[model samples]
Target: MTRRPVPEYAPDRLTAYEVPLRTGDALRTPHDIAAILRTVHTGTHIYLRDKVGTVMGTTLFTGDPATVTPAPFTNDDWSLTLLRCLASPSTEELPEARLCGFLFLAPDRLRLYLATEEAPSGMTAAGVRPGGALTALLAALPALLDEQRLTTTDADDPHCARVVDLTDW
Candidate 1:
């Protein structure tokens, strides 16, 4: 995959609450998110970008950025694709939804963080098919953000709280 840069998002600046109101079950904490990410096949990484075009840091999933088997992908590659997707316009008549940034894990794993100029009828970051950029990200992620903390990531774990929410979405 081509390399790209995923921007850094300041959770404080996030005001785009256009998310669909699903059971809080889906919204994962860092540990939970990390778990889901680990489920993906090795040699990949997962990242979450918010609706306001803010990029969070690279999710601390598996081994160090250095010595992972197969050499895990760098955030830069996935980040650029996400940015392009966010900047692209949607042809679909998703009247209630709009494309924001994306979750950059790898091939079959990702999340499509949505945004609405106004309040949303509900909060949902659905997996949407992309038109301009690669749609793999949209296809990879689950429809709803569910709970399930890291298998090893304890609530007491320093990165636990920060893992799922990552300080903030």
Candidate 2:
């Protein structure tokens, strides 16, 4: 089958949300997001919403972090990555969901822009499949933000205190 062209990144088309980072939350870097992606496993449950607020629930599987890719554009102040995911509908009435979106990480918030169509083969060939991973991450963000302050090593060392290593226990 012929494929549709991948649209260029457009900030206007994206919907932005403040990630609600608490005063001492350690989830302040793109590395933290990568760590979260690395932690996702198969059969993770996710709840998704479309532009109009329709909820689509599903369970998804993911490949390794190598499958996740950096977006084409660059912003010195933000971290931008693309996560491609396929959602198998939880109910028969709904169709399968193909999520090809950009997750932009700023120091204080996250900006998400989900394409309305399927991802191009060139993009999906890497196969990161972050549907469940991202959903689980966002769903647990509040708790994660709240719990980060408890993981620091030195309260007096600013850099050391802000370091959060989610890759390990």
Candidate 3:
């Protein structure tokens, strides 16, 4: 892991979006999520959230898609396996699991939080600027999720205002 300064932003408020995932969507696997992260960042800390919205564990992801090892998808153990697999140098496959959401700490002072359709609150972001890495990733996600429309809520909106769980990821 490398040392880096934390980005500055208000923790109590954030801009939110709804990333709806229909059945058979490509964002279903850990590998898929890894690929998405690689597109916007060379390396990133990934925070995986469990059911009822809690941080289960986290791992550093810096692997090529082809080099990733494939693993069986099981709802019960996928999160633990994913943390172990990505942390290991030899094995690197994103196991299959229900991606309720992810908190991605990208390079260049960008912090983006994504909550899938399954989550109660939608996607939220802070410290995002136009044409920044975070902005670029947000733009690309709509298409990556098979062109699912993203509904946005302003940061000041009461409905959008919520506390985001922040980890090193």
Candidate 4:
């Protein structure tokens, strides 16, 4: 059975972001959570990390956990669309997750929410950081997603925040 969809917004709150999709948007095949994830990444899961580990016994699946590979990057309008959605920070405060996809958005740091499935098409950026992912995205998405100037309220590093804008609906 299909599980009920996760709420687009947490109760009593709103996000600064908004996309073409709405809260009623379907979380199915072309527009599910992974769709958002893939949009954040584009065509690869390069953002996902599979760290090496030592096993004490043979009873565990000590290897990397496999994620379904994301689809192609045929969508030319993705970056522009996303940037526009995040262009304007709203006066109505929302859950942090809804605004930045990161938990916090500090003044100095910008919390980047790179989806796990947007790895680079090239083998060179396969595992190591793809230098152009953010650059390419920011350059292209300024107009389409002209919603807010996204910034983070934390030290410059990756970590989960308690709040973010999920109001991209």
Q: Could you estimate the TM-score for every candidate? A: 0.24, 0.20, 0.17, 0.17
| TM-score-better candidate, 1 vs 3 | 1
Report the C-alpha lDDT of model 1 over 37-88, residue by residue, as the tens digit. 3434445444344323423522222323222233233344445455554555
- State the C-alpha lDDT per candidate: 0.37, 0.32, 0.34, 0.32
Compare the candidates by TM-score and give the number of the best one.
1
Alpha-carbon runs more than 4 Å astray in model 2: 1-132, 148-150, 154-161
Compare candidates 1 and 2 on TM-score and give the better one.
1
Q: How many clashes would you count in candidate 1?
A: 23
lDDT of 2 by residue, 67-117 (tens): 433232233222223232123334565332233333323432332232222
Poorest lDDT segment (10 consecutive residues) of candidate 2: 120-129
Greater-TM-score candidate between 1 and 4: 1
Query: lDDT tens string, model 4, 42-154?
Result: 45333223332223421121111134343444333343334344444343643122223422233222333432222222110001111225444444432323233332233
Model 4 TM-score, 2 decimals: 0.17
Candidate 3 collision pairs: none
lDDT of 3 by residue, 1-169 (tens): 9987544443323222122232255544554444344443434434334212212232222333344333433332333343333233242543221233333334223233433443444444332222323234333442333322333345663433233322221
- Candidate closer to the true structure by TM-score (higher is better), 2 or 4: 2
Candidate 4 lowest-lDDT run of ten = 121-130
